[model samples]
Target: MQKKLVLGTAVAAVLAAGTFGAVSANASAPAAAPAAVVKADAGSDNLFRTNHLTIDAATDAAEAVLDAAEKENQRVSVAVVDRNGNTLVTLRGDGAGPQSYESAVKKAFTAVSWNAP
Candidate 1:
């Protein structure tokens, strides 16, 4: 009974030591990758860029351009777009009809895409 108790204690001590050693080793291991570590940006869908446009600015520019059209009594849609072919803002004159908004945006996108005046 004494020998068995001693042997059991030795086995338990060995297991406890091994567990402590393993925990100490793991604690001293090198840290994992940092939270702020930057990785290579993949694919073409980059989210870092922005195109700015204002309703006021686009409205002013477009109004000036469309003034002549309106003066000539033409019911045409005018579109305005930013430098990246994105629609900024649009204005449809009185009697310009329902599809005017679509036409204006399309024209603006086309103009900006092709870099037209």
Candidate 2:
């Protein structure tokens, strides 16, 4: 189970890196015609759009992690954090160690800080 967890984490990290790399590569390309442009609200010029997971999406992500761990008979804690490293959702699975909760939050924060999985 531990091996599987480690392998899965590694795979996810690799995939995330690849995805970010692709995005960066495309960013340098010449801009194409806009598909659709929505005018921003007045006085919004100082603010740039940013994407973050919704509450329900974050909860679903945490639940998915818990479910995967449970399938491996592993007690674990799952946490989802926003781009700013704020906790969005946390789940301490049955029989999870007390320390697991904090650890999960820290891990989630680190992932967010690095913009990696």
Candidate 3:
């Protein structure tokens, strides 16, 4: 019958289209670009910028520590250190002398080297 033939043709078209669609979908997508590998140059100890301060900044820190100690009525020596073990500033109270300076520097250096306060 004509109806059967038409139905057969319609079914065939649909099956053909489905097959095409499935094949296209399963096809591999374009390969992604390779990931970049950043290599660090040797002999450069700087992971980032260096940390250094001027004398004024160091003096200011000492002054602040001295003022805070005065307000708290505590006699102690204080030393501020850079990110490195280098001493930035140092302040000693009336009772603290040469020994206090050495002690404060040692404490600051220890803190810097250990990465702890």
Candidate 4:
């Protein structure tokens, strides 16, 4: 019985030592370096990048509409949106109702959706 107990203890100690050695080796191992990121140049052929409207152009369009409305003596709100339904400019004329703002936004979104002028 004494011999068997000694043999079992020796086996357990060997297994524990092996586990500790493996953990220590892993802890000392150097980590791999991160991959470098590549930047795209202006001449690069990137399919993800496409034409987009500039804020200046959108504001000009909204101003043109406001000019027309002013000439007609109309108190209204104007909203210019992009292809993605993002409002680039929103203008409310003098004495324009609060609901006119929401109406103008909806109109701009609808025009973008339908590709209307």
Candidate 5:
């Protein structure tokens, strides 16, 4: 029993020492360097400029749709999206259906994606 206890204690000490050494070695190691940021050149062929509608222009377009719907005695929602299919303006006219908001946005996105009216 005594021999067994002594052998077990020695094994435990060895494992503990190995764990501590590994931890200390890792702690002393240098940290990884940060990644460098590369800026794209203004005239780079990989990057192209895209024109999108301004907020004022998008809002005006949405308002025009709403006005036309109102003149036709129709309650509706209007949405204006940019060339990237990003919704810029959404107008829910009076008494418009609850689902009209999402529908209008989808319609605008579809139009922008297809580049159609």
Candidate 6:
């Protein structure tokens, strides 16, 4: 029993020593610096960061479309998309057809694809 106790204590002490050495080695190493940020110029190939419309502008465009529909005495849905063809605003006028929502989004996406106003 005494021999077994001594053997267990010796194994534990060796493992503890190894863990302490590894921790100290890692602690002494220098940390890596953060990556630097680079800004893209107007003619740069970073297209994703360019030609983005703010939420307010997108919403205004959508409202303008809705107002036009109102003047024509028609209920409709209007969608405004960013340069990336992602819908930023979708407005469904009162009594508009259920499918009008999808139609408006598709129209917005088509305009973006064709680079039209």
TM-scores for all candidates?
Answer: 0.47, 0.60, 0.51, 0.57, 0.56, 0.55
**Residue 60's C-alpha lDDT in candidate 5?**
48
7-114 in candidate 3: lDDT tens per residue? 222222111111101111111111131112333555677534322444454454455455555565545566656556566556666765456566666755665566
Q: Please give the lDDT score at residue 41 for candidate 5.
A: 75
Candidate 3 global Cα RMSD: 34.3
lDDT of 6 by residue, 40-115 (tens): 7868786433233445545544555555556656667666565567776777878787877777667657655775
Report every candidate's CA lDDT.
0.40, 0.49, 0.43, 0.46, 0.46, 0.46
Model 2 clash tally? 0
Candidate achieving higher TM-score, 2 or 5: 2
Model 6 compared with the native: what TM-score? 0.55
Q: What are the root-mean-square deviations of the candidates from the true structure over C-alphas?
A: 34.5, 12.7, 34.3, 33.3, 30.9, 30.3
Model number with the top lDDT: 2
Better of 1 and 3 by lDDT: 3
Scored against the true structure, residue 7 in model 2 reaches a CA lDDT of 31
Worst 10 residues of 4 by lDDT: 20-29
Clash pairs, candidate 4, are none
The reply for model 2, stretches above 4 Å from the true place, is: 1-39, 42-48
**Best-fitting candidate, scored by TM-score:** 2
Per-residue CA lDDT of model 5 for 1-117, tens digit only, reads 323322222222111111101111101101121112344677887864433344554454455555555666666666655446666667777888787777766655665566452
Candidate 5, position 34, lDDT: 17
Q: Model 4, which residues run further than 4 Å from truth? A: 1-49
**Weakest 10 consecutive residues, lDDT, candidate 3?**
20-29
Better of 1 and 5 by TM-score: 5
